[model samples]
Target: MATSAVPSDNLPTYKLVVVGDGGVGKSALTIQFFQKIFVPDYDPTIEDSYLKHTEIDGQWAILDVLDTAGQEEFSAMREQYMRTGDGFLIVFSVTDKASFEHVDRFHQLILRVKDRG
Candidate 1:
């Protein structure tokens, strides 16, 4: 027996921001998902580089992932992204524990910005 495809309920357009520290697979995931290429040993992203915009299923998106220095120390960079984004992916490497611990405060930052922009 076979079942038909389920239609997606109407959803508004979204602006997404992927946030994480350096060398935590954020760029790898973005390149793989959008560009459809995977370079296991690629170069790093400079502080300022324009990532390509892409469309999927009629929804327009620009994968503007952010890279902030001092992941171990607190910074205001993430709050800046959360201000304009409709959604986010806060990534941390499974192999690293320190990266995981720092995720908490960023969640709070997202909440605070949600009310503004």
Candidate 2:
């Protein structure tokens, strides 16, 4: 019989935060990856969700995924969390190049925040 290639339970947890515009499907990606469920046309309904005990490379992760508002009103709160996360998933739509441009600014902000932290 062929042997299974499952990893051991000694991997470290890593937090992955997705940040981007409203219609870019950050919520959908999160749901798809975490819940293993997918919808053809899902909305950005996740304000914040807890994905407990996620395993990556045999390590467990308690991901506190904070989905910030895509609107301009939540900029402050968004910046606050961006500064605090371990890493990020800054996505942009291929159809909208403008959003792609803004991702750099956000990426720079995260780097700055994490550097200071």
State in Å the error of residue 47, model 1: 5.6
- Candidate 1 residue 94 C-alpha distance from true site, Å: 0.8
Q: TM-score: which candidate is best?
A: 2
Global lDDT scores for all candidate models: 0.61, 0.69
Considering only N, C-alpha and C atoms within 3 Å, which residue pairs clash in candidate 1? none
TM-score of each: 0.62, 0.74
Judged by whole-model lDDT over C-alpha atoms, candidate 1 comes out at 0.61
TM-score of 2: 0.74
Alpha-carbon RMSD to native, per candidate: 6.3, 3.8
Error of 1 at 101 (Å): 1.3
Q: Which ten residues in a row are the worst by lDDT in model 1?
A: 46-55
The pairs that clash in candidate 2 are: 11-59
Off by over 4 Å in 1: 1-13, 46-74
